[model samples]
Target: MKATDRTPADLLRSALSEDPARPLVTFYDDETGERVELSVATFANWVAKTANLLQGEMSAEPGERVALLLPAHWQTAVWLLACSSVGVVADVGGDPAAADHVVAGPGRFEDGLACSGERIALSLAPLGRRFPTPPAGYADYAVEVPSQGDRFAPYAPVDPEECALIVAGAAYTGAEVVEQARADAPGLDLTGPGSRILSALPYDTWDGLAAGLYAPLAAGGSVVLCRNAGLLDDDALARRIESERVTATAR
Candidate 1:
């Protein structure tokens, strides 16, 4: 399938069925010179565990709002799918005061503490390590997620028409997100299967989320998500392209 147009959860299932070993997301941190690659199965495992924590531990349900305060990182991507699986709204960079749940990285821990209720913190550290101890009030994501079951079966139905994403003052239903990606794919020139894309666009904007996250996944391709892309010199960028076999780039 060149592109599977559906909800994020369905896209993941389709990708896994086609090829579990296929590289789904390659993450790079130019400033830290760190590299991590996740296959379809591996990424799905992360999603399931996180979803379990959200649905079972945090009591996340349909219509609940999750304020995502993390930056453009692999874990952030995992949260996007996790929320979709549990049928919670992913409010990216949303107002914490208005949220039911909050996921923050080390950088935003202080501000996230003021959120309405429920708090999860990601170290965003290498290998997803836990904080030394739980934060003042927030639960350490790394500490809690590991104990959750590997399998995920949502207790309630997740309607495709329900709002799954709310970002930058725009709301998108689960179906709308998939449809939008399909509509924008041709214009973005994302053609054929196994196309690898390197993207530096931040995920806070609609186009940024489309190009960096959705478009490639919709096209049955993969994404090389880069944080601190501006730090990479031309030679380094070219080297990454050659090494990762990247087919396209958006910065």
Candidate 2:
């Protein structure tokens, strides 16, 4: 489908309505060694709620940038989808300084462009605790906005030509590569609802975001996102492929 045809929110809405009970996310946490499953309905609601929070609580307007310095997790997925649903530009990158508003993990990096002045600090891990109070003009995430239920109306219409995600790298070089890569991606045999994709790439990369997430989701297939590519030997990967009946994979 063309980018201009429909927004990300449209795709999400369709997914939720078509199969509300279907598993939208299967997260494997290495820390606790646990697997958590989230259904389409639940994920959609979380996205809506997060979007509503961004709008009502944070006073974020459509098209404004929200920087996410998070790893691959359910929360990250919800944040990305929520930004898309509300027409807010989501900048997914390693450097939080590039974004006007920053959401970051605690104790990572405090002094930066984003942290300099009146910036917002949003904590995702602790969930309810607030800490590391901004020096002066800054505001805490929870204090600034009131918590509300996860309920949001769909966006009317959004222009897809506008930038949705921005990755960090040398501008000219990466932009050309990204254009070429996006063109090359569709040519792959990425069809089949039962097909499974195994991706070792990070979520921030174009290939990771497109093929690992968007492509499979668009094609009605499943994806397995691996945290450490180095740890997965050929034998292990092959075993997973066989066990899961994975039909396709991205090296």
Candidate 3:
């Protein structure tokens, strides 16, 4: 399917149905040096379950802003997909003041955010830690939500002209640009199963969303998010490209 032929949710549905066992995301933690893999089927189920929880349990109205302060990892992708599934506007923001709801990790920023009324906190545990019980205030993301099981909610018809994401501008700009650069990039093909991508950009930034996330998804390609190009710069990037056999990348 062409990038312009479908919405984000449409592409996700197609991907989930294509190969359930295919690896959708490969997460690597720089702090502990560990790798976690989430299959396309499993990730799709999680997105549906989380979307249900967000819409049913949390009572998050459609078009409501749910701020995500997540790192560039597999969970971020799942959350974005979940929000897209439920029609909730997932605000990937650093500033907590502008968000209606917030999902954060264990840190000063997570603890500092004030929770008023029936606010929900989706917290992540330390890397490689066994599933922990949900505390009085916070909800453990892995444990609290039940798996969507074999069934998934049917995809709601979406208007192609509607806004899907509100990605932050790169550098600093007052006006937000929402063009489909993925459709415009020349020589971009996502028809093969082994297609791979390497991205060193931050997820919250516009370039990262367009290149790292949207482009690959539009092309049905697997993405690898890296921290940096390493000390040797081009040499490290080249090594990664050679090792992963990346077919395409955005500089």
lDDT per residue for candidate 2 within 15-119, as digits (tens), equals 676677866665554444445566778777778777777766666666667777666655677777777777667777645554556665445336424543225
| CA lDDT of every candidate | 0.87, 0.59, 0.59
Q: Residue pairs in steric clash, candidate 3? A: none
How would you encode candidate 1's per-residue C-alpha lDDT over 1-251 as one tens digit per residue? 42433588878878888898999889988877778999989999999999999998999889899999988888998999999898999999998889999999877888898797899999887788788887777999988988888889999888889999998999999989888877776666678577888989888988888877777778888889999989989999999999999888889
Q: Worst ten-residue run, lDDT, model 1?
A: 1-10
Q: Best by lDDT, which number?
A: 1
Which stretches in model 3 have alpha-carbon errors above 4 Å? 2-5, 115-137, 147-150, 154-160, 169-181, 184-193, 228-239
Q: Which residue ranges in model 1 land beyond 4 Å of their true spot?
A: 1-5
RMSD after Cα superposition, model 1: 1.5
Per-candidate total of colliding backbone pairs: 0, 0, 0
Clashes of 2: 0
**Residues 89-183, model 3: lDDT tens digits:** 66676455665566665552444265432234444433524235544555556654664343446345444454445667332111112235345
